[model samples]
Target: MPNPADRNAMLEARRTLKMAQSPHAYVRGNTAKFYEWLAASPVSRRVPTGPAIWICGDCHLGNLGPIANGQGSVEIQIRDLDQAVIGNPAHDLIRLGLSLATAARGSDLPGVVTMRMMEEMIDGYAAAIHDPTSGVPGVESDIVRSVERAALGRRWRHLAKERLDAVEPRIPLGKKFWELSAEEREALTTLFAEKHVGAMILSLQGKPKDREVRLVDAAYWMKGCSSLGLLRYAAIVALKTRKGRWSYALVDLKEATTPIAPAAPGADMPDDDAERVVAAARHLSPYLGSRMMPVRMLDRSLFIRELTPQDLKLEVDQFSHGEAVRAARHLAFVVGTAHARQMDPATRTEWLAILEADRRGTLDTPSWLWESIVSLSGSHEAGYLDHCRRYALAA
Candidate 1:
């Protein structure tokens, strides 16, 4: 059992309020509930266990987005690995499908549109698995293209304004960033002093190997939905260049907790939560993975990474029929590419064969994916309404 002291009642209340806002918000915040339902569902036994590769265990649509690599090249991929584990690839597919379907419902799009999106999703996923080297298609969607443009045009000042509330060099401790306890602050200072941590800070800009890195400011970060009660901190570090100039980098340190998503039997992964998240990121999202470091902070397993302005999450509150189809295909391709790269040729072939099978009659999509989405969507909708009712009564 988790330590009761670690649970913050205030944050938990805030999280509940956020989840009650909408069905989509509820879906994003309740990953554990989804997994619990999946375990008990009849479809759980029928879903094929593909190659046991690292999967984004909480793979909702919001978790997939454009992230900048160390070289500053931005690509769409899974951005969160909090619940990542070496598990069945089918879980990712079903989770993503459910997310898209829920978004369609939120947008007031017709049920048929959701069905078509699922088909496009399977088509796109299969394409990537077949040709791992090819890039994801359907960037023509306005949402993705606009985000790409915004990410490309952003710089340090943009990041500073959005995250730090100013172009200043220090982190402000207030609503979004609470004051860190003295011990937590001391731990952060000690963490940045380590050789490997300093190397990671300098590696962000490919700064000279010997550049002096110093922790400028840090604070308790009040962020995220499901991860609200966990230990999270934001640290600002100054990198001194040889030219006697200094540049700042924002580093995010988040506690890694026991994942609710079950790993495959006999899966080989580090026992430490932080290491497990880093390992999965390396396999599933090399762009974000290359920039992350697993470390120990405050006697807890935590992962740290430099935050780039280009790192953005996908936000889709509404969708058109055409947009839904295109987005589904594009996003599925992104996820499939991540899963495909980890498997050998023979494993890929076997997985693809499994996915291609069980297509009903003239339908291009697999039956299991469609059925799983339908069932999960209904389950989540019922859960969301019940949650809202309880929240109302509490109010």
Candidate 2:
């Protein structure tokens, strides 16, 4: 962790600088602002009441990407669940729509292209609601395909090189990793000494379940936009198998907080925030959820998961007209599948009808969705400019 005296200030500076880089970056970093706008706007009342199910409360383009399951199978799914909750599914659709629209604006795409992307997004989502078991649509953009291929070919070496900047069995203390306090190190050592924690690491790599695990190295990890100020650590562990081979795993421990995204009224949820995040992940993104284990450290709730080389977020900074529309369809399809699987046949049918009923004669997409995107986009753009001005003055 950073020096306790300067941690918050340093992290706030870094977060602001990152969010000021582009409009899409701003959208990704400002989840609280997004929900606040929805709460204060009349548009919130118009959004259809979706079935109460687990949602990727902060669903945005940057949050969806390729993830590997415990068995090493790769699929596109929601990768972040810090803000997840049993909430209205329509909130996710609107959040994702805002992300796509802001990204289109960042890429300098015309307004008409953004409108078409929204139409395709609704079409793709409705398709999944109609048939949850159907395969992903074949209209993926070249950028997405390239990312999928890269994710499939990645291995431990790639992850070590990219994240740690080397394949050594230690976390280098530099820009991304910092020396941990003695107390922090001792807590991590005690946490990893538990039998269940050792078993979890061994199971991920198919090693002998009874083998002992050693914490080779640990550091305060600097990662994520919204999670910059939280308790984040990267710990590398080693286990020797009966065959005299050694296995290694990179574990990510992140603090969990109360979600800014509102949960459905009277929703029954776990009181522990970490437990809520873990449950949400399992329901919305099994590949990610399967690897997660909630734990407590220094009296704070945190969740630890083994990081796979194949897990990567989508980076859609620039988009052509064709790529724009295709990406909207494919990404929305992934989100729809997450939401649709939790609903029964009748519930899904009812949700689809609700979505379809919102479309006007000429507009293929729902007017409410389109209007929400436009309103949120305008608000965020102005917010971004104001944020940049303040950041500049601070610097």
Candidate 3:
């Protein structure tokens, strides 16, 4: 039996309700369950365990987006690192394929379209791994174009309004932002005062190393699906400028928990959860990792980073047949680029060769990928319906 107190029951109930809404939602919110099923499936054995590289364990559509680097340039990359680990890159590929296939089903596209998407996905990934210096293939989807344009035009005022509910500097404690406890507030105050934390804040704005950092306001953040019950907080900090002006930065502090996704058998990774997340982020998402620092707060490990307005999630609520094909190729290239960076030249060549071989009678996609998505999609649909039935009964 599970310990009820280990998790917040009310929040778990809310998570269940969110998962029951649709198959895509279920896939996004139930990564742990996905890993459990993957372990028990025969397809897991057939997929070659490529080089042990840091991988985004939950490489779904929603988690891939535009992230602005410290230099103020934005590019599409993996945005979430909660489940990151040094593992077989194949897991990320399959997870991403599962996500895209589920979205196609939600869009009511025929099964043939998904097959094509998988083939295109492999093509995009292989292209990146083979030629590391090549630019990402252009995607002509309107959604992609619009998101890029919006990210480029974002500024501090835009982030203030979206996160703080206003253009002012203080975080409002209500609805999305709950009031922090006494202990949490004190921990946050001390955290910002630390030398390393102050350096991280200044690293983003290119401020002087001696500049003072102050915690202006903070709140218990009520966000994310799978991470709902975890300790998450948003802090507003001000960096004093030489001209006596104050610039504010929004910092996200999230507790690092043990990953449900299995790492490669002999993979060497940090034992500390916070350190593990930071290490993986540094390898896979330089834009986000460069601005992040791991710290201890209230005796628990946490990862803290400054959030920029240009950091936006790729939202694919609906997709046309053409859009679906283009998205799969483009997003797979993004994930592949992350993985390819950590691989040596020899390893990259070997991995690409393995992926290209054995295309299962003109399908032009690895047989394991096709089989895995078909199986996982069916399993997730059944699980989604079962979840809805239970939720309805509980209510």
Instruction: Give the winner by lDDT.
Output: 2
Q: Per-residue lDDT for 182 in model 2?
A: 97
Q: Write the per-residue lDDT of candidate 1 for residues 1-395, one digit (tens) a residue.
A: 12335447667777889989888888888888789878899976778889899999999988988899988999888999999999999999988998889889889999999998988888888888998787846445677767877898889999999999989988886767777778887899898989889998788788976888889999877786655657888999999987999989999999999999989999998999999999999999999999999998777899999999998999997898899888988888989999999988899999988998877654466877887888888888899999999989998
Q: Which 10 consecutive residues of model 1 have the lowest summed lDDT?
A: 1-10
| Candidate 2: tens digits of C-alpha lDDT, residues 1-395 | 56855766667778999998988999999998999998998877788889999999999988998999888889889999988999999999999999999999889999999999999999889888888788566577677778878999999999999999999878999877889999999999999999898888888888778898989899988786655558889999888889777778999998899899999999998999999999999999999998999999999999999999999999986999999999999888899999999999999999998999989754388988999999999999999999999989988
Ranking by TM-score: 2, 1, 3
Model 3 misplaced stretches (Cα beyond 4 Å): 1-7, 138-140, 361-363
Off by over 4 Å in 1: 1-7, 138-140, 361-363
What global local distance difference test value does model 2 have? 0.89
TM-score to true structure, per model: 0.96, 0.98, 0.96
Scored by Cα lDDT, where does model 1 land?
A: 0.86
Compared with the true structure, all predictions reach lDDT values of 0.86, 0.89, 0.87
Q: Give lDDT: candidate 2, residue 157.
A: 96
Q: What lDDT tens digits, residue by residue, belong to model 3 across residues 102-204? A: 9999999999999999988998888789876685665545676679789999999999998888999988876577777788889999999999899888989
Checking candidate 3 for backbone clashes, the offending pairs are none
